[model samples]
Target: MAFSATARDSAVAEMNITPLVDVMLVLLVIFMVSAPLLTKTVDAALPQIVPPSLDTIKPLQMQLDVGDDGSYRLDGRLLTQSEVGERLAEAAISDPRAVLRVHASSGADYQQVVTALAEARNRGIANLSVQH
Candidate 1:
């Protein structure tokens, strides 16, 4: 007895994933080849500096305290906002590169400290520091 070929089996119902894997690998290779070109380039030139002499005297410090009652003090002496510049000028004459340290009480207004700093700047005080 001989067996006969017959179309009695069902057709394939699931997709073959080999082609999908091939496409994904191709895309990966393309991206790998182009990745370096996508990077951004930056051009910059920095200046060189010569060190200064170390024998320079330290900057003189002037303290400005702002009290809770909106009062201002210059080195423990009470003064108004307008007086801060005048006093700073006098201090700077002794030491041109003087630092102004401004201290404000916890309850003091922020604007009071700002005004004091402005006045010090106007007086050509090069160094300024704020103390908590």
Candidate 2:
């Protein structure tokens, strides 16, 4: 073989990726080991026993509908504004825990629906819902 002085002192231009690969593998393992610990759930003691009440009265559910012609109907029966108020008052008196659902027809006025809901609130109905 011929002796070449040019190759003796010149460094190789190739990159050494072994250390990079080793560092990446170490980081991957570290993350994998700590991931499960980061996801560990809190140990809590939630209440499992609930007491039953014998005198609990079931809440009454009533539906009120607003007609397309701006009329008010209670439980599918047509009624005037005063009558609706009276019926709501009666329901409130009979069962203050009554739930009222106000339904409005597609052609019904928004004011009518709002008025019905307001009336239910005035009658001391805390639970009320509006439907279409």
Candidate 3:
């Protein structure tokens, strides 16, 4: 077979990279324009956060004790049955999250302990415990 010199001259073997260069230049311009916009900031006022007070941070705790002689004591202070109820109600109002722990003596009358517990429950004492 005879080779034709004209056919070889007409054929182009080089890779075309014009579209690739055009895309890279467009991407460079886009990134350059967006880089400054990314660093731009707007001035605005942010709300200040107030630290929590001691009262809210610490839970309120109270202890009630029933003596064997049918007497009630709150925080080591002797109080009447009606006064116990009043104190519990005040505590509930002062801090609804207050915790009450009832401690009964070994010989304490069951009825007295029950009465105290019932009063505490009625006063909205959600956190309560009875100890013997």
Candidate 4:
């Protein structure tokens, strides 16, 4: 039925925030110590070149088609895989900058297309492109 004001006033009045501040300072020191260790450096050398003349001759286009049956064609004319390499080599010999375009049927074997590309590379054909 009664309350004591003097008894309440005797209790602790200051908040204990020292532990929180200590933890924050420890975390800050740990970050500062490990910051340089977390950083990384990388170096790279890029290429430099002179632009080609605008009046250079345009390269001729050679089209290679691979059918679903694994058959090959050069410019719509059916040919064997060996014949394809021979034809590409012949074209390259005439014009070093000849361009090759490859087209493969949806059902065609992926290895066939790769083989065609490899053959062209072996024959020094650099300007190669593929058509879906």
Candidate 5:
């Protein structure tokens, strides 16, 4: 271009907004096409939490230990089978809902442990369990 002095002055005074309008329209079309794609959602299965029930809550339990010498101990106190039965009966009488959790030593007699459990049951203990 060969522009006269008057034409140059006129062009300088008028703003050429074609590029601006074209850029704005291109941006609008790009956003219009990408808007829905960006708004797309994925389906997910979320885990739900459940409140604990009475059954789920562990009961208050007492420990019964069987020593290597076939001796019985309730709460670290040594006792004979009859004493164990007496203690268990007392505990059962105190709290019928409580559990008697028995733990036998690795070298303990299994039959004696079973006998202790039977004693607890004989004393009207309904909640008898063994611990690992």
Candidate 6:
């Protein structure tokens, strides 16, 4: 049956929101009651250890200097690009504890410095430092 378009009859065509409100209220109460039970805590008594200092012990380190003239040096001795990777790999293999410090000149190419850093990493140097 079609409802008349009169204003009084048009009220029947509107939605009844009472059931929706009741469901929302029920969900809110359920969440409020269960919220506390969802959280859990555990007591932990863990021991702490102090880390070693960098300035304390100075080990024998290997230095790689990249000059603005595109030259490489391993401990002040000049080397070509091809020799850098091979020599660094050997040094890393000989003493894994050896730290490799890269000193790039101010005018040195950014890509060259990055490439040298990558070469050290690729050679499996564990401790690498850069001096810009």
Query: Which candidate has the top score in lDDT?
Result: 3
How many angstroms is residue 32 displaced in model 6 relative to the true structure, after the best TM-score fit? 42
Q: Which should have the higher TM-score, number 2 or number 5?
A: 2
Displacement of the residue 105 alpha carbon in candidate 1, Å = 0.6
| Best-to-worst ranking by lDDT | 3, 4, 2, 5, 6, 1
Model 3, residue 57: distance off in Å is 1.4
Q: Estimate each model's TM-score.
A: 0.56, 0.59, 0.58, 0.58, 0.54, 0.55
Worst 10 residues of 2 by lDDT: 48-57
How well does candidate 1 match the true structure in TM-score terms? 0.56
lDDT of 4 by residue, 82-120 (tens): 889899899989989999999999999999999999999
lDDT of 4: 0.90
What is the alpha-carbon lDDT of model 6 when measured against the actual structure?
0.87
Runs in model 6 deviating more than 4 A are: 1-60
**Scored by CA lDDT, what does every candidate get?**
0.83, 0.89, 0.93, 0.90, 0.87, 0.87
How far out, in Å, is residue 2 in model 5? 81
- The residue-by-residue lDDT of candidate 2 on 49-123, one tens digit each, is 655663465799988989999998899899999899999999999988899999899999999888888888998
RMSD of each: 9.1, 9.3, 5.8, 8.9, 8.1, 12.1
Write down the TM-score for model 5: 0.54
Candidate 1 C-alpha lDDT tens digits along 22-130 = 9999999999999987896777898867557644557787788999999998889998877777888888788888888899999999988888888888788879899
Worst 10 residues of 5 by lDDT: 51-60
Best-fitting candidate, scored by TM-score: 2
Which candidate do you rate higher for TM-score, 2 or 3? 2
The residue ranges of model 3 lying beyond 4 angstroms of the native Cα positions read 1-56
- Candidate 2 shows a clash count of 0
Candidate 5 residues 1-132, lDDT tens each? 776899779878999899999999999999999999989999999997777685586656889999899998899999988888898888888777779889998999889988988998989789988964
Stretches off by above 4 angstroms in model 1 are 1-56
